[model samples]
Target: MKRINRLYIKSIFSALVISLLSCSDDFLTKEPKGVVVADLLNTPKGVDNLLIGAYSLLDGAGSSNGFPSYAYPASIRNWVWDCASDDAYKGTTLGDFATGGEVERYEALPTNQLIEQKWYVMYDGVSRANDVLKALAKAKVNMSEANVNVLSAQARFLRGFFHFRLQQMHFQIPYITEDVADPALVKNDHPVWDEVETDLQFAIDNLPESFPGEPGRATKWAAMAAKAHVHLFQKEFPAAKILLDAIIASGKFALVDNFRDNYTASTENNKESVFEIQSAVNDGTSQGFNGNPDSWTTNPYNRFLPTCCGMYQPSQDLVNAFKVDKDGLPLLGIGGPKYNDTNLKNDMGINSADNFVPDTHLLDPRLDWTVGRRGIPYLDWGINTGNEWVRDQVNGGPYIPIKQMFTKAAQKDASHTTFARATAINYRLYRYAHILLWRAECAIEENDLPKAMQLINQVRKRASDDFVMGKVNTYAFPSSVTIDVDYTKPAANYLLGEYKTFPSQAYAREALQMELRLETAMEGNRFFDLVRWEKDAEVLTKFVENDSKFRVFMKGAQYKKGVNDHWPIPQSQIDIQKGVLIQDPAF
Candidate 1:
């Protein structure tokens, strides 16, 4: 809840730009002397300037203003709900929305718009890194070999990072490392996954072990973490484990003790984060504009504005994933009877509770960390949610009347209620807990139940007040309880659900999945996690049926459609590419 915008202090682009421009008067001069081509372009300072220019892409109107970035596709598109629904991401059109829906053939026109944006942004990054790499090859700047290697490594890491995002989305994209021979030609070479792997491998091997005392700059650990993720995507489990373990053992990072710390603006640059997009709110008119997606999605006023886009919202599917307790327990069977608290309100406003279910707090720590309910004490909560009241949107649902969730304090200033205030929580891109889950996934794949259990318990150990731990006594259903829609099934029989203990492993897996569902939910991990685990079919089926916890809490009015799964690439891209680019199959 603390405002830590002050912690964002590193800005290498500015320094590089200044350094490059100061090299020679010819650098900024319009005409070359005596018609001779300027030598400044090839100079060390000029090369540095080029690198700065590459980084400048990150600050372009599309990205810096929070308009178009891979972050949108990567973090928001597929994750608004467990599986997309017309009510959510319109993912039902993707055929994976878990409900039976018509397949939406990719309309080249709309899909291309987003594709082009992501494509160009990533390539822009690659082009810049390539410039740095090329400069290092030829520049005669008098610097320590160590410094040169460090800088070069950072560049390669960035290049690899951009490529990784591109490859994941488009599956195939041109891997242009240098300025192409013809600037007019947008390179059309789409490399296979192997080639993408090769590029990332180079980054892993050559990157420096750490940044030069700066957090955002690429480091050896960042490269390794990226490599681990890439390897996982390729199903190279051993190599993935090796890379992940290397990063973990380096002792450079760990999970923050307070779960909420990872999301608070004040803790933006905390040690637990392995890597994160460095966002800083410019001073002056933009008092708190740090370029975070949270400012857009989670802020009260931003979402209400017609012009401001509503990228994502916590789906009832995800909101239901948290276990009532933390001791690695399941909630479905042991989760007990769902309870509704009419008085409950989100940090958003008074009627916010209309879309929320109170028993969600049965999950204890995870819920407290994920969403802000009525009573939690946050000084900033006072600033944002206090005494604010606003009309709630009709959420396009029939089961519940949409309610506005906020306090009188939040609604006072229309500007403060909007994203203009920077009240949204910053997402943690990488955390130590994910490492534990990663290891567990590997163990599960290997069928090493004991190892998987060990890692899971480690996470549980840290989450002291979670459901399985029995710390949350408020909603603890009696051991003899069972819930069945049939009404004929005895509550005791349902509670036992063929398990003797309250939160059994059968229930625990459900619990862990729910924990993951809630823990990483809107942050962008859900869709990918489902696909990677190949659990989409079954999980989404439940999602569409409105049987998932999120829907259950809302009394099951949401209809899941399959098309909601995959997003249609923006249409504008196809129009620009004409016949050059192809659209994704089934959109």
Candidate 2:
């Protein structure tokens, strides 16, 4: 059956007619002047209005609301880190989550509220798209035919986007198509994976190529990127590799030398970013409340912003993850007094008991680009959180050494008057570095070690002490494995006064995941990465149990059975479908 897509729109009211109409009996032959619902939507301009409504889908005012809808939920539902509350399901056990102050219980399929919101937002977008599709079938809009194609493509992207979200959250969902289709047929409880794949593939086929002006909407590359990701999750490895390879070979997307540029508002579409929700600075037309000082807690300034939310603190485990040099030497182990922690304290004008101190020999080029140590001055090109310290973890009030503060105050530049407010650092969604890593992942799975190593080196080469990139020339450190010092004792260790190997990929992957955790930290992709790699639950548990502050913080958390595995779908949905919709086994 051709996939069913439909939407319902209605107006309700009570009305009465005036007796003055009696005089109109003489004019009975004249055509009626009252507005008719169907007729109001049949004109050329009517189609234009409908198309405008379709475009609104991208802004997220409609059902498929951006960020908090799919992206936030996906990130929040998996294991990342605890911020304000220990009740985070993705961050803690469901049992412990219930005992905590946080609201959502993502583990229980029938009980969790996230699933309800997820299902609703998706269908809302689907219904709107359906309405536009139905209206276009009957009305020939006055605009050029090319515009019609673009409009149609946008609508399809929205529909496909919503469906894809449903597929991600719930493995099986009813596929909705055009407005004229039967509702019962469209609401089938167990739609096959192939059906959903086809919809995404269709969207990939119909979307426009990436152009100068199209920021928020899905482009051909975005669709293809989504497809590659979906196929990877589906375990269609070779197919995904082929598509990703094509995009990588296109040379259209290159790695930005300074990692910070990827997140700034003005520097968007900078070689990276396969697909992202386009955000702007103070443009009244955008959906995100971008400059809202109240919600700026997670803003780039939060790390540096003195007034914002400094809750998403990076763990020492994460801090020690960066490679000292690209040759793979670790920055933390065996190197005594990595950097004069005192220098970092002076630079940021703050003190950090647990701040990362890099080894002198292996201070990788990206080290300065990654974490904000104690004494380092806030550079315009890197993360601006003032100093290495994070304050209290429980309440947002006090500053404790164990829980050092990562606020915006660290990024303040005396030269720029507005440094206290906005920092233009861009959020990296998909960097060439990640693409290289992803390609390496596929190669590893395929047992193509040589190919994997080559791709890995391509990323490593950028961080080489050779400094061929010129832009980051000064920060690049040597990548040679010269020292293999053992760091077994605390007194002799660099961190604990111990000395060890100067540089290795053992630390590379650790640093990579750690940076990915901190860099993308609260952006909502952390938990997903862990689960996809089958390590979220295990790794998080290990970190929490071993770390004193984390243990104390997670003390009352409830770790229920299977809470670590998958989230439970909300029960309300299954009620609508009777027995057709089975709740996930544990739920």
lDDT (0 to 1) per candidate: 0.44, 0.43
Which regions of candidate 2 are displaced past 4 Å? 1-115, 140-149, 179-192, 284-295, 300-307, 323-374, 378-391, 395-431, 463-522, 547-549, 556-563, 575-580
* Model 1 CA lDDT for position 99: 21
Q: Per-residue lDDT tens digits of candidate 1, residues 154-203? A: 66666676666666555345555554553223433454456556656766
lDDT of 2 by residue, 1-587 (tens): 00000110111111011111111211111112544633555455555445444433332323323433333233211212233212122222233323222422222344555446546555656665665565566665555666566556666666776676566555466777774344333444563456556655766666667645645456667666766766756667788787778778888787666545554444556666776443222222132222211122332222333433342333344444432433344443334333212121112222333233333433443443333443333333332223323333232211211111122333332112332322223233455666666666666567665666566655555444321121111222123312222222211112111113214444444434443443343344555566555565666555444443433444544434345444455577666556555666654
Q: Relative to the unseen true structure, what is the C-alpha lDDT of residue 359 in candidate 1, on a scale of 0 to 100? A: 33
The prediction achieving the highest TM-score against the true structure is: 1
The deviation in Å at residue 288 for candidate 1 is 5.1
The best candidate by lDDT is 1
lDDT of 1 at 210: 58
CA shift of 248, model 2, Å? 1.9
